[model samples]
Target: MEKRTLGTAGPRVAPIGLGCMGMSWGYAESRRDDDTSIQVIRRALDAGVDLLDTAAVYGDGHNEHLVGRAIAGRRDEAVIATKGGLVVDDLATKQMHRDGRPETLRRQVEDSLTRLGIDRIDLYYLHRVDPAVPVEERLGRPRRPRY
Candidate 1:
């Protein structure tokens, strides 16, 4: 239950984090048991493992909802990391599309925050890179032309 810094400026979190993706989706089938998942999450937190990684794309946002419920009372003790940029077709179909446009990123983050019931995400990562758009454009930053 040792704490470690995620990055130079990032917050310190437990060394082990719960990856909630598999709990809700992936592995060729969904095994979403909110009750069990919540227990596991609570135990992890009680054991001092505070980092929880999830994504809006997982189970088409169901995973985030579950995690939100699990961490409701102990939000201050956890570090939540969720990804954006990939949109799922539906909760059942699980089809995906990448959209890293700056506007989309901003919108997705806002939506994710609402779904997760958190004011701010401790860590946010782009789920996939969109090749059609430049990284600078996707980040809403001006691109310095290469010489």
Candidate 2:
């Protein structure tokens, strides 16, 4: 499989990535089997698919755990992508919270690192923008809305 750079400074990864959301939880009833999911991830990597997309909010961090297990021995060969910010509870009510607060981001990133068994995440995204707080304030920087 061919490889491509994710960003100007990002690492090269296979063109295709495995979206592990289904293998973890969410989006209908959960039927995830850890062993199968891990095998699938391994197969993807063996086939040259290097990017894996997951989120902290997925399965309340269960997804990250699965990803961690799947990529245990192949960390250097894959690009891990995960998201943070959205909070969910037992009620399954997803509260879209903008937690890009620098401190929060730092903490979440650390937690994600621990869960994913990786020292650094290749990509991270804010799952949702918090309506209660201004984007600039939440992000701790100034920004202009793109038209």
Candidate 3:
């Protein structure tokens, strides 16, 4: 598999990143399988795929929990990436809203950490930009967030 650096000073990883969305959420609900998803993630790692993508809105956090389980033993081998900033108001209808305020982002990070069963996240993405908050204001002190 081809490999490349994620950034100027980031870890080297496989060119392909697995998006672990439909595995626990989206599309066919009758096909969600925890065991198989976990197996596939491990297999991907064994096959040189290190980046795994998931989001908080996916199944209202179910996807992250699944990812947490999948990388429990092999956490060192997987670079997990999850998104926040999108609040789910209606799980059944999949209604969501953007909330990029620092406070909201902090809370979301905490929830993500707990659900993912990890101390720190490799990459945290803002699911979307909130119209109410300025992007610069939201990211003024990106590294100074308490949560």
Candidate 4:
């Protein structure tokens, strides 16, 4: 498996990443099989595929849970990449809205950490940018909370 540097200073990862959305949600909901998905994720890890992409909005956080289970004993072998800032309006309809406020991101990050069963996420992405909020406010360095 060939590896490439993510961005200029990010971690080196395999050329191909395993997206766990379809396994838990997205396509063919009736065919969602947890056991098979776990096996596939494990196989991918064994094959040197390090990046695993997931998001909170996928199945309203189901995908993160599935990915967490898949990478349970192999945390060091994976680069868990997940997204936030998109709140699920309706899981059945796959409708969601962007919420990039600092508080919302903080909550989402905490929730994702809990759902993924990880101390820290390897990579975090904003699933969608909220036009109502400035990008800097969402992506900027964390400011000391004004109590």
Worst 10 residues of 2 by lDDT: 138-147
Better of 1 and 3 by lDDT: 3
Alpha-carbon lDDT of model 2: 0.79
Least accurate 10 contiguous residues by lDDT in model 4: 138-147
Put down candidate 3 lDDT per residue, 36-120, tens digits, no spaces: 9999998999999999999999999999999999899788888888998899999888898999898888888899899989988
Give the Cα RMSD of candidate 4: 4.0
- Clashes in candidate 1: how many? 0
In model 3, what is the error at residue 134, expressed in angstroms? 1.0
Instruction: Output the number of the lDDT-best candidate.
Output: 4
* Per-model CA lDDT versus the true structure: 0.85, 0.79, 0.87, 0.89
Q: Each candidate's TM vs. the true structure?
A: 0.89, 0.83, 0.92, 0.93
Clashing pairs in 3: none
| TM-score, predicted candidate 4 vs. hidden true structure | 0.93
**Candidate 3: minimum summed lDDT over ten consecutive residues — where?**
138-147
Query: What TM-score does candidate 1 reach?
Result: 0.89
TM-score-best of 2 and 4: 4
Q: What would you estimate as the lDDT of candidate 4?
A: 0.89
Candidates 1 and 2 compared by TM-score, better number:
1
Candidate 4 segments whose C-alpha is farther than 4 A from its true place = 142-147
